[model samples]
Target: MKHYYGVKVANKIARVMVSSPERSGGQNQYIETPTIEKPSDERSAKLVDLILENITDTYTLESVAEYCMMSVRSFSRNFKSSNAISFNAWLINVRLNYSLELLESTSLTVSEISERAGFHSEQIYRKHFIKKYDIPPKAWQKIFKSPNHN
Candidate 1:
């Protein structure tokens, strides 16, 4: 009887572990780390800082290139070389990470979160979030929200 109970408990534990998204190789695989390292060159470093500071604002490749005082083609090449990711890809990762933080920390609606996260529309935000998380924003919030301390 003791051995049977132990086996049953082990089976339950295995099921729980396998069902977890982290263990199942799910959405986490797509979400990149949000940190941006300073580039070796002063201009690229400045660009990285500017993007980090203005993550909640809309920006275009042209605008970013101008801000960095480089031609669009030059900026794109330099940025990709320094960051190992395309500028747009990095921007999307940053915005999605910010949205995830807001969702976990606040009770804001999805539209409000989308706006604050720099997405042009809630639909766009939802699309990206679903793509990266394998779940909708509300569902993610429900799963990860902090426990009430009260």
Candidate 2:
């Protein structure tokens, strides 16, 4: 059986766990992440909103840059600087979040959600979904029901 110790940080509970380590530290080391801070920009924020609103539509970085009235290079740099992620990554995250919301609020199948979430195929959705959530979409749905109340 696996054992866990709980720790509190910023009023949030987190579990310190021991498991089969993926690397040489043997499950003892805490994961490290770099802090890359980027101040938000209005143009990038507007572009993100547009992307989320039209997730089912096909739009490229160039198009989004045009929408923001800037050249693609400048838009890309500002987007990365403001969001710490690329435009495509932000689009994927928006689509994934939409899929997750549908899964939790509607009785949509994985394929239907994939279609509506702008994923080209169920396989693609499953791949990114697992990467983001650490579980298959169906497995997540099975473990949690669609909420019955608003």
Candidate 3:
């Protein structure tokens, strides 16, 4: 069974691939089992869940580490091992995803959405959004609303 985790810290799904032996053997005559790491243990997983639930709040490595009762160094290493991205990168993607959700579902303006999404400014949001998606928020909205319009 394949499990998909919406790793909030990374703002991406961590998919655990479980392929049949036949397929794996066909793909590679000599196959190596890929190693996968889970972001947090049971205790840390709970902390991660809490942080994800309160993503709208101000969050930092120190804050989350304190919440998990771990040192910054240990937390940072574990977080990277599990999520495969730095904390800041994950947070930005999360905020951007949140902003996109708001843009698609709400009538809020860019500034308002940026503020609510914890983005520093509208300009920053636009820059990153365009960089990631190759389209501005406004254009994305139009395209989402009218799928056939091109």
lDDT of residue 20 for candidate 2: 23
| TM-score preference between candidates 1 and 3, better one | 1
**Between 1 and 3, whose lDDT is larger?**
1
The better candidate by lDDT, 1 or 2, is 1
Q: What is the lDDT of candidate 3?
A: 0.62
Error of 1 at 53 (Å): 2.0
Off by over 4 Å in 3: 1-38, 146-150
Order the numbered candidates by lDDT, best leading.
Answer: 1, 2, 3
lDDT of model 1, residue 96: 87
- Model 2's alpha-carbon lDDT is 0.66
- Measured against the true structure, the TM-scores of the candidates, in listed sequence, are 0.75, 0.68, 0.64
lDDT of each: 0.73, 0.66, 0.62
TM-score of 2: 0.68
Alpha carbon RMSD to native, model 3: 10.4
Per-residue lDDT tens digits for candidate 3, residues 44-85, read 677656655666677888987787788999888877777777
Query: Which candidate has the top score in TM-score?
Result: 1
